[model samples]
Target: MDRQTEFVLRAVEDRNVKFIRLWFTDVLGFLKSVAIAPAELEGAFSEGIGFDGSAIEGYARVYEADMIAHPDPTTFQLLPWRTKAGTARMFCDITMPDGSPAMADPRHVLKRALKKAADKGFTFYTHPEIEFFLLRADAPWNAPEPLDSGGYFDHTTLDEGTDFRRDAITMLEQMGISVEFSHHEGAPGQHEIDLRYADALSMADNIMTFKVVLKEVAVGQGIRASFLPKPFTEHPGSGMHTHVSLFEGDQNAFYDATDEVRLSKIGKHFIAGLLAHSHEITAVTNQWVNSYKRLAWGGEAPSYVCWGRNNRSALVRVPLFKPDKASSARVEYRAIDSACNPYLAYALLLNAGLDGIDKEMPLPPEAEDDVWSLTDRERSSMGIDTLPRNLENAIAVMEESELVAETLGEHVFDYFLRNKRAEFDEYRRQVTPQELETLLPRL
Candidate 1:
């Protein structure tokens, strides 16, 4: 066994871990776990544990159902807030029984994208500003009531859930997830947690773990934490405005001291690529029927496709640069909701950015004025574009995009397209209470 595997073995024994959970995610980003006793862990590390992939959504066809879960030793950590006997978990990579990477595996999708970046001597890093809501436990599942009536940065008294948030942060820290900041967000009962920047893959895993920890901590209280993109139509919706930067070796590739915004040619091109592909990747980033509600609403959710310095109204914004902090230079992509599948979302993002780098796509003019407030004439004159307005439209956009199809590969691309189409159809078929309430009384 290698050093990391051996270390995990020793650590599991010392920690008195009764079970080691092998965790991965489906295409929709829902976490899936399978546990093994300590006696079976060494074998799992060497040979991997087998599972029926066909049973998993977007995984495999019935005939080709056999798949293996190879636990990632680096991701080994004890599950914090586990009420049961000592339990640990590790993220796993799904592969075919013949040792080939499963093309449908979201992790494999990201790995391919990362390998492309590596080929160019670049590494992608991300810091996500994840936002969600804390609601009363007994609140109706469909219409959850906020636990508190506080808004943005509301202190101890206003933000009544400080203890719960603190407990969540503690649990996350215990599991080795570093949270940079946690504060009450603009919406009532909504909060934002900014995770420390890390490589895309590790950060994706951290995000998945972060959500679980948040919910677990919330359950411990008399409340429930939700990651639904737009739980309340009247209030601002949750968003995962992600900060992205690229690096080469010890230096930041995105930074250019000579440039006005301190952005390198590479950085500018990368942003240009992102803008060009924003619509194409929208389905993957904000992949839900309700996600469009968040996108369509113009508050913090961006509908227009444009980039600018510190312009929250634009889909992409280059955060203000500090004179001494060159490493902090990055672009924040604002359209992604907190509920997205980080694995596929991050993969698509990296690929989109790389496409820009590869094609040397030129950066468009910065939209200093609020793109959201602009009239059609003004936006048209400025070449400003808009993202897909709904899930069905987003799916159609994804279907036609050669770039999206190529990035996701045939299997995932086909599966994702079909799955999202069905979701949109189902959503369309439903007669929402709002529709009935307004139409029945009016007509």
Candidate 2:
């Protein structure tokens, strides 16, 4: 057995872990788990646990439902919230009975993308500033009541949000997830947590764990935590503004101290690639129908396809350079919502950026003024294009992109498109309250 696998087994025994939850994600990024007794750890590591893939959201058909989930020992961590005999968890990689990686596995898709980056002598890293809202537990799904009225960075002596964040952070840290910052966002009851940067794979795992920890803590407090893109019509929406960087042998590939913007040729090309393919990838980054609502009503969430230095209005923002911390040089893609499947989202992002580097795409002119403020004519004249205005438009654009198709593989690409189209169809037929309110009295 590998050292990591042996170490995991030893840890489970030493900790007296009663159940070990093997975790994986569906194509749409929902967490799925299956618990096994500690005695099965060794067998799981070697042969994997069998499950019915057809039961999952975007897995195999019923006839070919057999699948295996091989636990990644490197991701082993005990659940801080669980007590008594204790419970631990490990992220699993889905595979077929023959041990071949599942093409539809979102985690495998990311690994494939990362392998491409590795082949190019680069490593991808991401740091996400995830935002969400805390609502009253008893609040109705349609009418969510905010747990607190505190606005951005407002910290009262005895704030419920603050206590919740504290507890959440504690649980995360216990699981070895390092948090960089936590603060109240601009919207009432909304909170933001910035996780320390890590490799794309590990960071994706952390994000998944982060969401579960938040929800667990919230439920324990008689509250509900939501990662919905636009939970409330009048309030600012939650977003996962992720900072991404590429590295080579301990050096930041994006750093060019001598350049005017301190961005190297590689960095510029990456940004250019993201801008070029922003529309095609929007369906994955902002997948939900409501995600468009958040993007269109822009304050922090950007709707246009452009990049700028310290410009939050643009889709991609290059944070100001700190000469002392060249490693910190990176670009933030702001359109990604907290609810996105991190694995697929990061895969598409890495592939897009890598495509730019491969092609040496030219960086477009920076949006000096706020993109949201610019008139349609002015934006068009400046060559600044807006992202797909809605999920339908976004899916249409994605459906035609070879880059998205190739990166996501045939299994995922076809399933995601079909699934999203069905979702949009269902959503369209629904009679929303706003539509009734406006049209009922008129027509």
Candidate 3:
């Protein structure tokens, strides 16, 4: 057995872990879990635990229901919230009965994209500033109530949200997930947590774990947490403003010492690729119906496709470079929300950036003014394009994208498109509260 596997076995025994949960995600990024006793750990490491994939969303047909979940020992961590019988969890990679990687598996999709980057001598890294809302646990879904009314970075004494964040960060650190910062966001009840940067695959796994941990912590505190893109109309939406960079064997590939902006040619191309393909990939990054509401609602989220050095209004922002810290130089893509499927979203982002590098795509003129302030005519004249106004439009654009299709394999691509279409259709048939309040009495 490998050293990591042996180490996991030893840790389980020494820690007295009675239940080991095997965790994986479906196509829609929902966490799935299956628990096994301690005695099955060795067998699970060798041969995987079997499950029926037919029941899973976008997994397989009933005829081909047999699937395996192989635990990744590197991801094994004891659950801080579960202390009764000593529960531990590890992220799993799904495979078919024949031992081939499942095409529909979101983790496998990311690994494939990472392998492509590896072949080109590049390693992708991501740092996400994830935002969410803390709401009253007993509040109704449609008329939800915020737990607090604190503003951006307000250090209110005796704040419940603050205590929740402290506990959440402590638990995350206990699991070896590094957190850089936590603060109150602009909107009431909304908060932000910035996780330290890591490799793409590990970061994706961390994001999934981060979401679960936050929800679990909220439940323990007798409150609720939400990652919905646009929970309230008047408040700014929750977003995952992710900073991404490429590295070449310990060197920052995005840094250029002699450049005016200190951004290398490779860095410019990466931004160009993201701008060029942002529209097509919007369905995956901002996948829900409400996600478009956040993008187009004139909030902090960007609606136009453009990049700038310090302009938060633009879709991509290149943070200022510190003199001695070349490693910190990176580009932040702001359109992604905290609710996205990070695995597929990261894969598309990496592939699009790599495509730019491959094609030697030119960077466009940076938007010095606020993109939201510019008139439509002015934006059009300046070659600034807006993202899809709604999920239907986003899906239509994605349907014709070869980059998205190739990055997400055929199985996932087809399933996601169909699922989104169904969701949009269901949404369209509903009579919204706005419609009733606006036209019901008048009609």
Candidate 4:
């Protein structure tokens, strides 16, 4: 066994870990798990545990039923909440019965995209400022009520939810994840926790852990932690505002000493590529029916496809760096919501940026003003594009993009489009209460 695997096994034994949960994700980025006894750890490291892939969503057909999950030893960690049973967890990679890489695996999709970035001497790092809501449980799939009346960093009345956030951050640190900042967001009971920057793969794994930890802490405190993008109509929606940068060895490829906005040539190209493919990759970044509700015009969220410095209304914003902190310089993409699959989202994002670098695409002029307030003609004159309004429009653009098809292999791309299209169609057929309220009385 590799040294990492051996070390993980030793740690498990030392911790008295009885069960080791093998964790993975489907195409939509939903976490899947299977538990094995601690004794089977060595065998699983050498030969993966077998499972039927055909039953899993976006995995395989019945003809290709046999699959295996090979755990990554470096990701081994004890479940902090399950200390009574002494359970450990490790993320796994899916493989075919023949020991070949599975094309449908989301982790493999991300690795393939990362390999493309690596080929050009680049490494992608991401920091996600994840926003979520603490709510009472839903009665019957209906919207849940917020647990706090506070808004935008409010600290009034020192509620139990405040204590929940504080304790949750402590637990997160105990599990080896760092939280850079946490505060109340613009909406009621909506909170954001910003994570430290890490490589794309590690950040993806951390996101899963963060979600699980948040929910566990919420449940312990008798509340529900929700990552739903648009849970309420009048309230601001939750988002996963992601900051990303590219590195070459130790140097930040996105930064330069002498440049406007302190962005390098490569950085400009990356921004351009992101804007170019923004419409195409919308389906992956905002991968749900409710996602577009958060992207609506007039909200603080981005609706126009333009890059800027310190402008939240733009799809991509370059955060200004202090005089001494060049390495901290990076662009934040505001289009992604909390509901997306992090692996697929990062893959398409990196791929789009790299495509710009390969083609030497010129960056568009920055929009310093609020582009959301402008009329259609004004926006057009500014050379700014808009994102797809909904899932249907987003899928239409995705279906036509060569970049999307190439980035997400044929299998995933096809599966995602078919699934999303069906979703949009179902949504269209459904007559909502809003429609009923208006049409029923009038008719």
Candidate 5:
């Protein structure tokens, strides 16, 4: 056995990790888990546990039913809250019965995209500022109770949820995850915790852990924590505004201190590619009907397809660089919501950015003035395009995009469209409370 596998085995025994949960996610980012006894873990590490892929959404069809979950030893960590039997967890990589990668697996999607970057002598790194809301357990979806009436960077008396957040950071630290900073967001009860930048794959794994840790902490405190894109209509929606950059060997490929935006040629190309394909990738970034509510909000949510330096309104921004921190010289994509699957989201992002580099796309003029204020005609004249306003619209754009299909692979492309179309159809049939209130009396 490898050293990492042996270490995990030893840790499980020493920590009394009785129920080891194997974790993975569907294409839509919903967490899935299965537990195995400690005795079976060694066999699982050597030979993966088998499951029916046809049963999983966006997985294989009935003809290709068999799949395997190979647990990644490096991800093994004890669930600090699961003291009943001292449970542990590890994320898995899904593969076919024959041991080939399952194309529909989101992790595999990212690995494929990363291979493209690797081929080009580059590696992608990401740091996400994940924002979420803490609401009272009984609070309605549209009317959530704020744990704190605090604004951006507000520091007030510690509430139950505040204690939960503190415990969450502590638990995350214990799991070998480094948190850069944590603070209250602009909206009441909303907060953001930024993770230190790491390779794209590792960052994706961290995101999964982060969500579970947040929920575990909240459950312990008796308040519900939500990562919903726009849980409340009046307040700012939660965003996973992620900063990304590329590296060539040990040097930051995105940094060129002399350029106008202090961006290297590769960085400019990457930005151009992302902006050019932003609309194409929007379906993956903001993947739900509720996600549109956040994207259309204009202030923090980026609606216009433009780039700027230190501008929050633009979809892409070159964050102000600090001297002596070359590693921090990167661009932030403000369009993505917390609802997205990080694995697939990162895959599409890397694919889009790499496409720009391969094509040597030129960066467009910066939109210093707010692009959201412009008329439709004005935006069109400036070559600024808006993202799809709804899931239906986004899916239609995705269905037509050759690049999206190529990046996501055929298995995922077909399955995702079918699932989303069904969701939109169900949404179409539902009569919301607003419809009942307005149409019942008037129509």
Candidate 6:
């Protein structure tokens, strides 16, 4: 047996594991799993577990429904909250009955993007500042109410959600997920957890697992966790501000000690490409109807396409360089929300940066002032472009994007557009409470 397989099997036996969960994500980025008893481990590791692809959103048509999920042994980990005597989980790669990688799989989309980066001698690393809210457990799914009045970095005495975060972080650590920091956010009942950087693929898997664990911990504590982009309008929305860096072997490709900004030409070009294509990818990066609400009503959620040093107002910002820590030099994309499909989001960011590198795009000037507050004349003079205002416009922008289409593959690209269109229609047809309150009496 290979080392990975041997390790997983031995761990299962030694730990007295009774059940193994084979985890995979559907195209919409929802976690889907099937549990297997101990007797089924060998066959699963060898031949994989089968499921009906037709039932999954954007997965397969009725005619060609057969699919398989090959468990990745390296991802084996015990669910710390569950009984050790037989519950473990591992991520899986979706494949066709014939063993080909499923094109519709979000994981495969990311793998293809990673391969493209590999061909150019680059490795992608990402660290995400994932933010979410702890809400009243009794609240309806459609409308979540806050659990506390805590604001940014409040003490446990003031931040009622503190113990919940501590518990969640402990459980995450036990599951082998390394968290860099956790604290209350700017909004009441909202929190942020920063995960240490890892390779793009491993980080995506961690993000998926992180969401599951966060919800599980919240429910156990008699609270509900939400990653929705804009659950509240009066308060700041939860965003997944992401830090991105490129590596060429052991060296940080983005760093240049001699440059005034300390960003290499490659780094500058990468940011330029990201800025150039930022509009096209928002439909994927900010994929929900409510996501545009966060973007349009900015609360540290960037909508302008510009980059700067130490400027959070810009869409991308070059973080302050740490002396002797070359790897810390990276660009932070601020527009992405915690609710996005991590695999697709990472893919677009990498590919967009690569495109800029290939084109040798020149970096634009920094926008140090608040872009949101800038007058139209001033913004136009600065050559800064705003992101799409709504999901309909975002979908339309994505429809015309060659980069997004190629990155997602035809299966996902087409399905995503169709699905989003339906969502827009459903949303537009609704008579919102706000409309009823404001318009009925006046009209």
By lDDT, the best candidate is 3
Write the residue-wise lDDT of candidate 1 on 321-343 in tens digits.
57347788888999998789998
Question: lDDT for every model?
Answer: 0.91, 0.94, 0.95, 0.90, 0.89, 0.92
CA shift at 345, candidate 3, in angstroms? 0.3
Model 5, span 219-321: residue lDDT tens = 7787888888887778889899999999999999998877767789999999999998988888899888888889878798998899988688899999986
Q: What lDDT is obtained when candidate 6 is compared to the true structure?
A: 0.92
Worst 10 residues of 6 by lDDT: 154-163
User: Between 3 and 5, whose TM-score is larger?
Assistant: 3
Give model 1's TM-score versus the native structure: 0.98
* Candidate 1, superposed: residue stretches over 4 Å from native: 158-160, 321-324
What TM-score, over all chains together, does every model reach? 0.98, 0.99, 0.99, 0.98, 0.96, 0.98
Could you give candidate 2's per-residue lDDT for residues 1-443 as a string of tens digits?
98999899899888889999999999999999999998888999889999999999999999989999999999999999998769999999999999999998999999999999999999999999999999998879888999988889987776789899999999999999999999999888999999999999999999999999999999899999999999888888999999999999899999998888889999999999999999999999999999998997887889998998878999999998574478988999999997899999999999999999999999999988988888999999999988999999999999999999999999999999999999999999999999899999999
- Poorest lDDT segment (10 consecutive residues) of candidate 3: 320-329
Q: Compared with the true structure, what per-residue lDDT tens digits does model 6 show for residues 106-196?
A: 9999999999999999999999999998899888977778999888888767344988888889988998889999999999889999999
* Residue runs of model 2 more than 4 Å from their true location after superposition: 321-324
Worst 10 residues of 5 by lDDT: 320-329
What is candidate 3's CA lDDT for residue 376? 99
- Candidate 2 Cα lDDT to native: 0.94
RMSD, candidate 5, Å: 1.5
Per-candidate RMSD, Å = 1.1, 0.8, 0.8, 1.2, 1.5, 1.2
lDDT accuracy of residue 2 in candidate 1:
97
Worst 10 residues of 2 by lDDT: 320-329
Sort by lDDT, top down from the best: 3, 2, 6, 1, 4, 5
User: Which lDDT tens digits does candidate 3 get at residues 190-299?
Assistant: 99999999999999999999999999999999999999999999889999999999999999999998887788999999999999999999999999999988997774
